[model samples]
Target: MKGNWLLLIGAYFSAVFYSTAFCVVTLHVDPESHYLEGGKEGTLEIWLEGVQNSEEVFEFTINVSTNNEDVFEITDKVLVVGSIKSKVPYTTHKAGNALISFEQVSGHHDNADNGTIVSDVGDVYAHIYVIRSQPLNVFNIIVGWIYFTAWSMSFYPQLYENITRRSVVGLNFDFLSFNMLGYIVYSIFNVGLYWIPKVQDEYRDEHPGQLIPVKLNDVFFSLHGGLLTAITIGTCFIYERGNQSVSWICRVSISIGLTYILTLAIISSTDKFPNCTWWHFVSWISYIKLIVTVVKYCPQAYMNYSRQSTTGWSIGNVLLDLTGGICSLLQAFLIAYNSDDWPSLIANPVKFGLGILTIIFDAVFMVQHYILYADAHYSKSGRFLSGGGSKKGYKKIHDSEKGSSENSNFFRT
Candidate 1:
């Protein structure tokens, strides 16, 4: 019992560490990864990366204002990243400072030009407007919410099964604990920003008309953080007491950790935080470690599977996995169409990949349900029939030896 409690504690902390690691790798993005454009500015050649390296030209109307409240304007037609043959000049605006805004030409690519900003001393601020080259939509939020609901709904049956069995037979407390801790850390990340009421006010005032900036990775990580926390708490209850199902629970945990967790972490970390050198290094190392841990425990999972005579997969978990998967898939597609978010999703593929795995697991779980829970005598037929002609005959005496013999075979085999 003491050992079990110790393991449980260990699992909880492990979950915390891994979840934090997962959130960081998946969500953290470096602002420095974007291009900066503020130096001595003559003709600020603003050229965005275009399809096939071809040039797309945009026209801009420049504005300048001084601390002394003097305002001046200029109209210039420029081809970005390409040389200007002729310079168009109006009354040269006083060198105090300048603001440039570029609107795309009508009836071409729907993409527009982000404005370049110049400091009072003619220094370039490398103003980045991530809004160019994309269409905006509400589908991302909608799909994300759907996925959230599905994953959340998965906990019920798992909770019921664990309670009914009076043990965490087919669940893994350690794995779930780590998963939950990750979600908790993630959910709280952007919470600090909310306390600064000024930020909210400023954001609302300047959004769209002004510079509305956000980190894509951070939001997704926060979402995952909350989801995992709920999963962790539910898993803890499932394994609260060691009972007839402990072995199978451990096995299922190992299976999930192997089939999904490691790959999910690796792909997301690499894709989302590629700009963070330290994060990149740590993420790769964690990925390798997680894979190793899962592999090392594969035999243990197999043993439990054999003894349990079931897949040890939970319906609730499968439902969550399936729901999360569909939601994530839609999220990926939605993100893919936008230029700003495309980088983040492409940078971190864990959400996308794990979503796929969850779907596969959902399919397997249905099979497990029919073969195991729905048909209890399915796997035990060979053993039961060798001794007696009827399952009822074995049930009477087997009831007396049920807990011990089953438990013993789990370890001996």
Candidate 2:
């Protein structure tokens, strides 16, 4: 009889154990990453997500860790927060990226300490940036905006120059062709990563616990750039294009680009490479854009060099490109120093190389315009210039535009 009673008690405990799970308590960091000046301090809040309908007051003992001890000093101690949330303060000793993380030591609830167990989530974390110059943070931010705006605005000058001169005589067709192809592929990459849920899911699944790198601004930039390039290409068709055509070299390059993407699409359809998924396709398109960035300016630069003049090519474009490139590189330096993330530059060599390469090409263009080929003015009338090549083209354009050129924007440059 006693054995039967004991068996009934054991059966009851087993059922209870099988039916219930430990209550989970979630802790969230307010800002996943934050910036701070050297020798300054700031606080990041830790908010608790507890079981629903339970008004139980909870407290936890938290522990802290940091990546750089010299730049950041945080000792692991008991964090006693007796409410739903608490602010954690950190101090930056120097200029370095300080990675801060928190661990839960123990936790308690006011009611049902035994029957309702509280399960602790692994960790809550945030970043601490100790920038070299606090005042320069604002400058860095401004430069970031400047580069973005400058790059976006840079496209207009060429478009205007084509309309103003009524000819794309000195504008190398090779440059346009490569640029158009690049923007198209870039738009595809950005749109896929930014909007397509399946691609995002694939990206996240491939890189677990990592944030999606693409943002709405990225989408905006690529799409805006693509639209502008398309319009410019359209203008090429209507405008008086002198003795120039999309070079066979550029045609072959474009063919390769198309073939590369299409072949990847085919491979993705098959199971040849297990890892060649949707995200891989997106990444490959981005690679094409990267390659384009590296080489797009070559044709334009070479064309200027050959012509011994900066006639059709816009100096405004060169100036804006220079502004964007310089700002971009400086901002990169500021960010890398502040975040102690020098490796990230290496990780994204395409973007870094793009900035450096652009700056170099801009310098070359500036030298060509200012010193190497300074004889003639980049004038729309081409009347005062010494070159007959420009004169002949602009005279034809002037005759054609005598009726419509009055409304041309004088302030376009």
What TM-score do all the candidates reach, one by one? 0.41, 0.74
- Give per-residue CA lDDT, model 2, range 217-306, as digits (tens): 778888898898888878777766545667677888899999999998898778578689878988887788888888888998887765
Q: Which tens-of-lDDT digit does each residue in 1-413 have in candidate 1?
A: 99999999999999976553332111010121222122221333343321221232333333332222222334544433222232433232222223344443321222434322211212112222222222233556677777776765665666566555544433543444444434443333333233335444434343322332334444554565466447545544434322333345445644664555445546645656534332233333334333332332243234334443332335666667677777777767655544233555656565455456556656655554555334343222112111222324322223322323333222222
| lDDT for model 1 | 0.41
Candidate 2 accuracy as lDDT: 0.70
Question: Could you tell me which 10 consecutive residues in candidate 1 have the lowest summed lDDT?
Answer: 24-33
Candidate 2's C-alpha runs over 4 A off are 1-27, 53-67, 73-83, 101-125, 197-212, 265-274, 338-347, 376-413
Error of 1 at 274 (Å): 17
> In model 2, what are the clashing residue pairs, if there are any?
none
